[model samples]
Target: MTDILGYRAKFGVLGPSTNTTVQPEMDEMRPAGVTNHYSRIIVDNANALSDETFLKGTALIDQGTVDAVRGVMTCAPDYLVMGMSAITFYGGAKGAEQWQSNIEEVAGVKSFIGSVSVVEAFKAIGGIKKVAFLSPYYPVANTEVRNFLSDYGFETVADHPFRAPTWTAIAEITHKQVREVVEQMNDDNVDAILQVGTNLCMARLAGRLEQELNKPVVAINTATYWHALRANGITDKVSGFGRLLEEL
Candidate 1:
């Protein structure tokens, strides 16, 4: 046995190999005593997203995900995180629960997926019924997310996606552009503003946007990390994100 029980507060993240935003977001959200590691799976390069592309990447994704967690399992991280939101949102509510259980079984450690963490954060903030969303994916990916959330019993009141073709473009998007997309999602009837793209740089602005919008504005990355920290009972107050993690 590697004896993972004796190490410090380390976390392992399973993310897309090309993802450029998950680490920065994790760094911003993690508290003083914690650290992070990453495992990358195949992802669309920069041109397009297609079923063929996803199919080609499936074996790589599965292998990389297992390898990432297994490698980190040596260090015995207290927790594991699935850093991609789309995969987390797959299979809906039933899928989310099974994924959590599967990760724990394979990793021999507690685990969380970004989408599940987002839902847990919503519950923590006492949000139910309805919410709005902003995404940086094409219509196909957008439909997947919508269906996942609806299956979880959350009404998708309204949503706007920028229809980006690749994850790299989503990560390369500037903060100013993200804020503009945020403006496009403004609605009076939605209970909150939810974003689901780890590639999107909405974490740093979560606090200010929530205050300005007068409702919870949850960046997917932020909520995921918040849920991880909370799941481990680590309650260090993280500022600059939003009231969800700061004042909750």
Candidate 2:
């Protein structure tokens, strides 16, 4: 039998333990009968981070993913939503495929991952060539995201990195902080701007900016969840987050 509230579809979402942003942002975008079940990949808050330490911390989160998957699989979710983005962008497009393939194999179901989902969103929206991005990650992780996007034939005209010192600090990034970065990255040559870190909480800002900037302001959480719903054949046309959900 299907879950009571999730009779339409139950998405098993996986993210780092220190993430407090993706869940709420995603819930606000959910359509009727679609429910989100989150399973945290346990990791101590990486407080005092540099490029080296940040890599180590993310490695810990990577190690915990399978256990998180098993925990969520108990609900028999119809699909998986990988709420983390850094790890998926680690080895470029081919590496993203392998990472997601492992998760899907473990969950025994189809899955939607953040990195690839954002690429799909760009494709659906069409004609997005040069791009810029902002991230809560250190330069190390940002390199991976750039590489992943480059693999998909998108060029990085400009990008910004917040290098949030702790996993929790990523969620602490303010709207003003993001807009400042957007202002810095905004260029006539860049057709779209993207925010990569899921915990950075940019979906709402992204949607609002698209109107103000007259360009696609793509947020990872919005892209991933929108990919999940659309790939599952649920065409709800969710609003508020961005055009990816509201129109495409």
Candidate 3:
């Protein structure tokens, strides 16, 4: 008999080895007929958190990603979803497009990347123009995110960076810290609140905050997953992740 679970689609998710949030969050959002398979890219030098070091870490992630994708391709997933956000947001829209094209060329599969997914999510939410966001990145990465948004015609009204010293440390950020940042970023000027960084554990929090703020609060993991599903024509309205998945 054919397996019923994951019979509809299988997704291959790639993330950093030090990340502890993406897998669990993605697992929570999975529907009955969908399955997610993950491959972790190595991050051997996860010391000192600075713009330079963060970029170096991203380079390391890039180095391992092709191999990781090749390994996961054995599963023959219907699509690829990048569970990491920093690399995707590094070079704005054109850069992200090139990155996705390269990955697809290597893996022989289409992908829903973090940077592109966020842009699409904002568009789906009625073309939200102004946004505030939080990230567990260094100042340089934050700047890249802002630039990325700007390229897509979205204005960033406010942003907060956790500046975690190591990739592992990113997962240690407390939910209390996230709430405070969300509160700081929330205002009438911004149309939405966005949370980048896959290891920050903001999926459920984004959902709850959306109800409180009466605006969209989106986590990267949620956006990427929702994008992958919808791109493949899976319109399953997943609950408890956020309005992006539940209502869009």
TM-scores for all candidates: the values are 0.88, 0.98, 0.97
| Candidate 1 segments exceeding 4 Å error | 1-8, 42-46, 49-63
Regions of model 3 farther than 4 Å from truth? 1-4
Could you tell me the C-alpha RMSD of candidate 2 in Å?
A: 0.9
Per-residue lDDT of candidate 1, residues 1-248 (tens digit):
33343234688877877788898888777777688877666544644566444434433554567766787788667788777776667678787788678778999888878788878888888856688888776556567678888887888877877665665777877778877877776777778888887877788787788888888888888888888888787888888999767976
lDDT of 3 by residue, 86-174 (tens): 88987888899999999999988899899999999999988599999999888889999999999989999999989988888888999
Worst 10 residues of 3 by lDDT: 42-51
What is candidate 1's local distance difference test score? 0.76
Q: lDDT of each structure?
A: 0.76, 0.92, 0.90
Which residue ranges in model 2 land beyond 4 Å of their true spot?
Answer: none
Q: Order of candidates by lDDT, top first?
A: 2, 3, 1
Give the winner by lDDT: 2
Give per-residue CA lDDT, model 2, range 87-137, as digits (tens). Answer: 999999999999989988898999999999989999999999899999999
